[model samples]
Target: MRWITSISYKNGDGEVALAFAPEIAQFLVQLKKHFTSYQLSKAAALRSTYSWRLFENLERFRETGIWEVDMDRFHTIMETPKSYRRNFNDARRFVIDPALAELAAKTNITAQVEPIRRGRKIDRLRFTFENASQMKLAL
Candidate 1:
């Protein structure tokens, strides 16, 4: 499902409208119950697209503090390109690691990736993280 379908705004007027697909609308309804919402200000401050996407993904599992995603599905979710898909190391270095680093440095969360392997090849990634404020409170 696409995150956004179309956006329209007047040239000089202070009015705008966004049209989302039915699936996106349903997703938003479901998000209200299962997801932890982030402040728009904070989200807008993120400079990297990967960082923003990672934050949203992790926020959905904020309560659980852990998320497991297959590498293929993760790549799809991140909208990774075909070239990067062929090299796991490159994908990790350029995409996943940078995203995680940005999230840890700029946001209220921190995460680590644990690669799940099938024989000798990496297959999935298990992300474990916690809200920094929550961690402080627990300590």
Candidate 2:
């Protein structure tokens, strides 16, 4: 049988000892950002899940000795995704929600959002409000 192991190296344990297959390493890189070397090393030990398969024949991994299977395949099996959720609370902290509330106090008309675009060099992210006669931007 093969089982993927993610050994923790905390409180001064070689910092980072794992050497995964190239794909597995890349997958980890994508998930982590703005982390220091110490943080990255700790994050590497986190595993979403493990994958295992029992070998029918005895010679599946090695001739006779014990085997250490890389957890790449197991990571791959659990990595299939369904949907992405935007963190609305955190997003509100940064932008937009307060601005909408401010607009509500100013206008007697109802407002619907058109799409919000990312700001460029001079152009700002804009929100549009539509009443009966015309549409105006609330930027």
Candidate 3:
């Protein structure tokens, strides 16, 4: 099913209108009522899929400022390649670093990821994030 079914322009005024599928319209209305516009705008502005996904996951922990995920889950969520999935250096260099950089540059979030070691190998990741909006409220 498509989200946007049609688009049109108004006569003379040159205004544009979008016609969304019913499910999409309902979902958008709900999002508008319940979600913050700032967060939505930030998500829209992000260029990397990794950055966008990371932003979404971190927003849930804005109040707590921390998120921990198993390496396997992180790999699944970020869709890292087989090579990168097992290699922490490659994953961090190719996936994590770029995503974090984009998020810092494009959004008001500052985040850092630290790998947790289990025995001799990395097993999990701990993410600490601070949102500018949250910081302003705290100040």
Candidate 4:
């Protein structure tokens, strides 16, 4: 579907406006929408595509405060390169670590990764995250 059908200047002060497709507008108006404008802005501000993808996924579990995924699923979700898929360190160094760090730096969310091990190999990655505002409310 066409997410946006038209765009125009709404005012003399250079304010712009968008006309979204009917289905897109209706979806946005629906209850329990997938994300907020703030989250989308934060994701857009990220430099790495990896960070953007991770931020989008993380927002889904923002309230729950944790996101866990097995190695295979993580690779699929992140869309990592062949080298990264073959080596956990490569994935962490090139994809996961930098993405997490960028998200922490650019957004109000902080995350920590815990890699679960199965014998001599990494099995899954657990991400525990928190919004700064939520943490402040708890204090």
Candidate 5:
């Protein structure tokens, strides 16, 4: 469950590469904990996405219960680089893993992400980027 990322120097927007696995949730937790600073890449944007181009760890969702099911409007915004994460941290706070966030700054490993939209049965998929787009770094 390794992913590559595309970081944007412009407004800090970027893309992602998706790789699904049984440990997807745990893997994403690691990413949230380690993909900060300059470790981010661009390939990650295209890995496994449709609307929500960003990555989400299922384990984190279960542990923290910070899941968002209907974020179509947000994903719509990220589809354009011009309207990426307005307040970088603000955008990721709810979607990403919290423990990883606590450690992100320590290692400078955080990927400013873009949120994707969702499909009809997206609820069934544990790890899905099928409804997201990439854009922005911060507000």
Candidate 6:
């Protein structure tokens, strides 16, 4: 689904305008009713693109509280290039760790990564997180 249909901007005066398809509005309203949503402020505070992407992906699974993603699929979702695919440790160090750290510090959720290993090689990553707001309410 396309989030934006058209955009207009003024060169000298810095005026900007956006036009969305009528269908998008309906879709957004339905999405709010059917799926979990995140705070725009929190999303904006994320320092890296990876952090923002991971947060959105995790937020969708908030009801389940856990998400298991295969390394290949995760890399695809994160748009990692071929060079980074060969080194899981480097990828985790440069991408996943920083993103998860920023996410934990700046957002109302916390996540832990559990690597699933296959005979000395890591295959998948299991992510577990809890909604802090819900946890507080439970207490």
Q: Distance from true position, residue 134, model 1, in Å? A: 8.0
Candidate lDDT (C-alpha), each: 0.84, 0.31, 0.85, 0.84, 0.36, 0.84
RMSD of 2: 22.8
What candidate 3 gets wrong by more than 4 Å, as runs, is 1-38, 134-139
What's the CA error at residue 80 for candidate 1, in Å?
Answer: 0.6
lDDT of 6 by residue, 106-137 (tens): 78779988989988888999999987873222
lDDT by residue (tens digit), candidate 3, 1-60:
888899999899989999999988878877865653344766777888889878888987
Sort the predicted structures by TM-score, highest score first.
1, 4, 6, 3, 2, 5
Instruction: Name the best candidate (by lDDT).
Output: 3
- Model 2 residue 72 distance off true place after TM-score fit, in angstroms: 36
Better of 5 and 6 by lDDT: 6
- Summing lDDT over every window of 10 consecutive residues in candidate 5, give the lowest-scoring window: 123-132
Off by over 4 Å in 4: 1-38, 134-139
Clashes of each: 0, 0, 0, 0, 43, 0
| Sequence-dependent TM-score of model 2 | 0.19
- Model 3 TM: 0.68
lDDT of 5 at 86: 45
TM-score, each model?
Answer: 0.70, 0.19, 0.68, 0.70, 0.18, 0.69
lDDT, candidate 2, residue 3? 30
What is the TM-score (0 to 1) of candidate 4?
A: 0.70
What's model 1's lDDT at 44?
A: 71
**Candidate 6: where are CA atoms >4 Å away?**
1-36, 134-139
The superposed Cα distance between candidate 6 and the true structure at residue 42, in angstroms, equals 2.1
Q: How high a TM-score does candidate 1 get?
A: 0.70
TM-score-best of 3 and 4: 4
